[model samples]
Target: MNHRMIDRNREEGHARLYRDYFSDAPTYTETHFRRRFRMRRSLFLRIEEAVTTHDNYFTQRTDVVGVRGLSSLQKVTAALRMLSYGTAGDAVDDYVRIGESTTIESLKRFVKAIVEVYGDEYLRRTNDEDVSRLLRENEQRGFPEMLGSIDCMHWKWKNCQTGWQDRSHLFEDLAESHGPKVRYTVNGYEYNMGYYLADGIYPSRTTFVKTISKPQGKKRKYFAYAQESVRKDVEEHLEFYNLDLQ
Candidate 1:
């Protein structure tokens, strides 16, 4: 497909997916810059600031080399090609009319710049809020403690060495499962349900408690006993109830 046409279509598809999976609420004036997710703005600028501050000379070399520092921009273009459309190196050349070596270098530079600059500082660790406050702050359909659901997917990831880290005894897990380059689910298994809920694929969204009844049994044992909020947070959110959510 023509690169222009493909990019246009990809942008449209992303907008559609965002609309479907998430709601776009009216902009709240109360929101501050720090309060908002920085994704909507330029993160590369932040990385550049860090480099210049620490006298990372590579930034200066690549940024101003050959026609006013097209290096960063080139890598960004290359990375976006793969990230947006899953296009390989040759495919990127076909689209951008760039040489294969240039394309490969673009990818390498992009990866190096990204890793060396921004790391896990970009990930959201956790949020600590009581159930009542959580409900009042950001009430969803009904599920309060309920955050998100899961759907099964299969992926053919590249690289065996990196794939070895499976969250178990890293070394032992590596040794235990070694063979025909097979891709397994990240958290595979029924009882492997990370949440407190039983492992079954009612493959659902979420539904909060229907009644305000007291915690009655094992699932509802919270009534008679005041469990530590920390423990509750630590445990899976979907444990209580006979309702096998579908």
Candidate 2:
């Protein structure tokens, strides 16, 4: 087996990438960066900084033969481009000057580094403060005691269990005798359990609030619309990243 060396000129790619996005006076504006990257420039830079610090593969390094490899910017940009556009790995080669194999490898490492660096805070169980924040936000949106929106991505299986349910540790606290309690009044009726806005497919569980199948009057119709609009948060977030939400 033989390998081809294309001389991607990684240094020039890094220079162009930095000048266009990371330099003090970048060629592109923050708005453009946000539109393409699916996140604010500040957030992207923060992720880049964290990943570079966490993973040495992202840092530019010289080989034993004194040949410098791709800089952190080129590697990160390549990985982000693939994620943001859902494009093929080779699609970023011309700009990022990263080979297809290298682009794929960078993406794998970037994902791993991101998980290792930020997973604890972002992926942990929701605490009291989080529940409180969600309660406040949902209350303003006409959904008192609503925890958050819930949705599922259907997948085929050989023999799956019963219909999907909230099997996470989310409801564990609610079951505890001395756990955090949420109380709210709706239409003169007081409720204790915080619920999530789900779809019709979900079971009629007290913790899962689904919209009306056929909203009758103006009030019901409005409520249905509002609930659905709020429930699509996860879908909207997935779309922003060019991911297949379903």
Candidate 3:
């Protein structure tokens, strides 16, 4: 699923990216050199198969070949990049003959259609079996109300229009050479619906745990350090798995 075709458009960009990575640099055979870098085909199908099959296609039935006058591979690559782009469908507009807004709308509809075929998924607490598993992992009291850990994660946003550039922040880039950006959020802590464990910096709610008290003495300091250390351990674990994806 992580494979990608090294088409002409992406070649120039990737070449510049990997310039330092390769010894000889600019001019080289991608098919031969990718083994050195271990770039595999993320996209499973060839351009021909897309044109021929897919009765279950998400879009309104159209003659993709005749109307767009483009190959299936080119179109699929452009579409996938939109998910990573902060500018949404901008690359699609450049790669295909279409309005940017139309491309964005189509991709949104495609994602929804795929997920619907899969399931209506979200962070809400489900049945008790899932609840029990989470509590045992956290060493919390059995039958806690909440789901899992309470934490914020950053999802990287790619290149934005000049005006919006300042709003985005890149996180640790991937080992696959994918750029990193982040969107932070709160997750269920302890249980599917239990209170959050937070520091003075994080906001407090009646449903969550927060440490915002004025420091009265040494006991408070000790407890704060304990929570802080545990939180760091969790983040380190997350970061470890993130590298595994690479």
TM-score of each candidate structure, all chains considered together: 0.35, 0.64, 0.35
Angstrom error of the Cα, residue 109, model 1: value is: 3.3
Model 1: per-residue lDDT, tens digit, 1-246?
653422223233333323432235423321332123211113333543444444333242423434333233333454545543456676644433444555676656555555455433321222333223433322243333332222111212222224523422322232343211222233362221112111132222122112213656775565223333322332323221111121
**lDDT per prediction?**
0.34, 0.73, 0.39
- Higher lDDT: candidate 1 or 3? 3
- Ordering by lDDT: 2, 3, 1
Rank ordering of all candidates by TM-score, starting from the highest: 2, 3, 1
Deviating ranges (above 4 Å) for candidate 2: 141-246
After superposing candidate 3 on the true structure, give the runs of residues whose Cα lies further than 4 Å from its correct spot.
Answer: 1-9, 12-123, 140-147, 152-193, 199-203, 212-216, 235-246
Candidate 2 per-residue C-alpha lDDT over 1-246 given as tens digits, one digit per residue, 9 for 90 to 100: 598789988889988988998899999998888677766677677778889999999989999989899998888888888876678999989888899999999999997897688667664577888778878877877777777775543422111122211333443433332223688777798767678777876655667778988999998999898888888753334332311111
Q: Model 3, 1-246: lDDT tens per residue?
A: 996533344333333434523335534565543332223232223221332244134233336553322333333434445643334566555434434555565556544443343233321224456445544555553223333333433222232213223422211211122221212234542222343344444333443455536656797876566556655554434222222334
Model 1, position 196: C-alpha lDDT score: 15
Question: Could you tell me the TM-score of candidate 2?
Answer: 0.64
Number of clashing pairs per prediction, in order: 2, 0, 23
